[model samples]
Target: MFSEERRQEIYTIIREQKKVKVAQLAEKFSVTLETIRSDLKYLEGEGLIKRCHGGAILGKQEIKKISKFSDSFDISCLLHDLLIVRERKDRKPEGKVCVLGSFVVDIIANVDSFPKVGELINSKSNSIGPGGKGTNQAMAASFSDAKVHLITKVGEDHFSKYAYKYLQESGIDSFTIFQTEIEPTGSSISYLADKTQNNITATYLGANNTFSEQEIDISLPYVSEADVLLLQGEINIEANIKAAMFAKSVNKIIVLNVAPYSEDLKQLYATLDFITLNANQASHWADIEINDINDATQAINVISGDENKKVIIYMDELGVVYFDGRATFHIPPMPSLRVDTMAATDAFNGAFASKIAAGGTMHESVLFASAFLSAFIEQKGVTAMPVLSQVQARLKSRLEDIRPQIICNEKRCI
Candidate 1:
């Protein structure tokens, strides 16, 4: 029974001041400590805040949005019209995604409940799917019609072959898919329940941990050639920083998706073009309390700053919070049925990058990504990503549906 309005107000206060005690919050809101705890629990669940020993801190995300529009498109007078024209053919970018991070085969089981520790519960259906933050991000970029160059390691095993061939067939580059024989390829074990809550696992490193700085040096050339480099935290932290610096040196846009909450990501923030994350990762890394959805903006601004950096906070069904230098956009989720929550952010980043690469502004890119992701979530897995034309079609259809409701008032009709 936590009110979003109350949660957001308290969260905003804490974020502004950097700390808020239970007494302060309760005194300000006239609520008991127990009620405040419930609010904290809800915020914690959304990945927006952390409950410290006593008070709370701003989440790790500095959500900043950048203004990428030209003078013609930057005017607030044109925003409504802008949404309609976003699907125009002028905004498609084609290059390739140089993905840097881990790759693994995801094994998902749909089950009713966990068996006793010593026993087993059978599943209604199971799947051997392509995933891992890096791979998923690569697939997401590919689905946006960008050529993808994946830099990862997998065991020289059957799963590696399957993953490689799938990437190849789907048109992702495999030049950097190095192999190792020391252990099996990494795989994630997941158990999905009827409520959509699930348990997941990652095997200890496996071949993915084998990637070294030397290997990153070898791939620096590719990073230079690509328009953008997408990175995930699952890789060795040092290697990731090295690659980010290299890409930045060449003026390549670096987009980071920091997951798994590695303590080693201290320097990753200052070097990114955009950092997308769930609420908790933002809270954990940025030291913010995200008690409500709107409070996400405060967390985001803390991580990236009120400067030119762009930080996208993907809050799942709550939609996305984008902070650019000029403004903040709280775009609600496009109504759609979500089959699986995995890989959606990757799809968002891929499409967003494609829009930027194609010379669209940040606003345009986010809108495209939002709509594209809506489509992906409606289907299941990475295979749901559509080609550029299909994405446009969906946008067109959605916009057309809303156009009639917007009366032009004669003066602005044209």
Candidate 2:
């Protein structure tokens, strides 16, 4: 056997037994005593084991035993135990995610309906908050327990404070968030109809347009370190293209969310591992009118032909359709009370990207993302986004409800 494989076996033995003698390993592997000693030395150097008196033991630091305590035990012992637990949790490995997008302030107003060209109307309510496809998606990924790095541009204005504070509180690394002195921060004005829950939006690409290829190049280190990179259409198209190319160079998985329908994204499909879009955006990209799942399937086939590209089309209320070149499947939506649907797509993309970064398969990620959005839309705004635990709980409940169908399907296949 190869030395590396033998060493791995030796490490496993040491871990399982907590200690192992050199003679025993040499005899078990049919190797010389010198070879066993070398393997043990290598493992010890790599911190997988510790050598002592012709034997080796597991490398993990020994935990101290707590003494017997009475009812009047000191509080410091409890604190020490809590500290140890926290340290162990913190030292565990975690996945890294990089998000490239825009950070815009959303000025939302509730209106009765669309006004005529020369008509005037009064809004029921108005509120402003931090938004933008990039910021929202980054926040979503962070809430899903991934270490997220958000790359975007904002102006050195008052609006930028919201981005800073939000990212800091969300535990997202914003070191790549460039600040422009000339351009103002991006802003979006939306009018939401109270009855139908449909809305129209207008965005001012202020600082969002300022991110150039140079800025994208500066973020190459973060992109290279990420297991998965997420891009959206809110930033400059050239910068997005550069980001995609850089990620591809480093063999990082790329998940692109084509929002607001950009014609430039047609050239990017071949470079992306997965492309997510709403029904209208997919219809436009595929040059077909997608009225339902059948139309979406046709569109997916048109867009993903010949290339190994995957596509996800969000069909409102119906569900989401996924096409992975070889097969097509529909993920049913989880039912929930709809309060605000503005951030639904962002929530889905973020959770999906998080799952991908955490090494989940495409189907698993989509299921988790669907459950996350179901829990997200039940709340009011961006502040109401659900965490990873809440989403997992909801997904568990959903799976339990569908267990019977799963069992039946398995039996039929068998």
- Of the candidates shown, which would achieve the greatest lDDT relative to the real structure? 2
How much is the lDDT of residue 191 in candidate 2? Answer: 87
Which residue segments of model 2 deviate by more than 4 Å? 1-93, 173-175, 400-414
Candidate 2 lDDT tens digits, 329-382: 777678788888887899999989988898988888888888889899888887
Per-residue lDDT of 1-414 in model 1, one digit per residue for the tens?
Answer: 114335655556755687678777887665789878887776555444667877677556422211321121222212231011112243343665688877788888877765567996789888888777787777667667666677877787788767655654554533356666776678887776646644455545677777767668867878887888888877778888999998888888888887867767757766788887778888887688776665777776676664457777877767777666555666767767767656677788777776666667776777788888888877765566666677778777775332212112221121
Q: Tell me the RMSD of model 2 versus the true structure.
A: 15.4
- RMSD in order of candidates: 23.7, 15.4
Pairs that collide in candidate 2 are none
198: Cα error in model 2, Å:
2.0
lDDT of 2: 0.76
- CA deviation > 4 Å runs, candidate 1: 1-93, 112-120, 197-203, 306-308, 399-414
Instruction: Give the C-alpha miss distance for residue 33 in model 2, angstroms.
Output: 65
